[model samples]
Target: MTQSAARPAGRRGQRLTYLVKRLEMAERARMEEVLRPLGVTLHQYTALSILEAREGLSSAQLARRHVVTPQAMHQLIATMERDRLIERRPDEGNRRILRAWLTEHGVQVLKECHRAVDDVEERMLSRLAPEEAVAFGSALERCLESLTVPPEGLARHGDRTA
Candidate 1:
């Protein structure tokens, strides 16, 4: 039996997973509540940042950067287009390719969303010293890296030889 099986009903990762999901949903809702008043979604804000940071990216490239499928990116782009927050136009070098850019309205909205995220992070992590928060973030990254497996390979807790 797996370790999860040995544990009491729902007293494990699944429970933890649910809690994490709820926390994320709640946080996202809070972010939306703040951003909606200014006319934007968190995903839209992230896309705006990517657009500002990258000079030229096709929908496919942007989708890959965000680890989402092109279809999803198209939908997001369409919504942003309707909101006048972004523009998709043919790339100069490749007519078949499309590039996305943030509009001036998009820039203003992103700035506000950035401030909101900063405020949220500061409020949420106020209990932790800055260094402790940095260290904890680094540890989370390490834990995630440890969970990676070689192609066609697997391990239990990253310790089993395979």
Candidate 2:
């Protein structure tokens, strides 16, 4: 059993999940401060980064990846298009479906955001030794996978539609 699993129930503050959530909140605050000057919210930065990696994704696809509703993603895409950070064109396969890609301006902005976010990440990881940092990331990935992937004969969380 894990250290947390072995521990007797106590204050909620003592839980590992609580500590992880606190860390996530702190990191998000720091990222927001850094990104604010660049006129990018965390959501926008994430969408831009995803578009850079996988161009031509529809808003629905982006929504699924973002774990948000398609309507929300549509609003975000519209905002980005207004900012000239992304362009949408009709898909060749389906003229009705519009696919999104980053513009040159978007790429430049994303690069700047990347550097700023990297600094935030570096600061967050500064306390850990290099090896410890790697292990921590691996452990977090395992934890995420355990939650996201359902056990055999069980339906996934929030997968009722599927």
Provide the clashing-pair count of each candidate structure. Answer: 0, 0
How many clashing pairs does model 2 include? 0
> Candidate 2 lDDT, tens digit per residue, 1-162?
798676545356367777788889999999999999999999999999899989999999999888889999999999999999999999999999999999999999999999999999999999999999999898787667667687642344433324
How far out, in Å, is residue 161 in model 2? 30
Question: For model 1, how does the per-residue alpha-carbon lDDT over 1-162 read when each residue is reduced to its tens digit?
Answer: 799765434335456446557757877877777788777877877778888899468999999887788898899989998998888789888899988888888778788888988887777668899999898677556545555654344454443333
State which candidate has the highest lDDT.
Answer: 2
Q: So what's the TM-score on candidate 2?
A: 0.86
CA RMSD, predictions in order: 4.7, 5.5
Output the TM-score of candidate 1: 0.72
lDDT score of residue 150 within candidate 2: 70
Model 2 RMSD in Å is 5.5
Q: Backbone clash tally for model 1?
A: 0
Per-model TM-score on C-alpha atoms: 0.72, 0.86
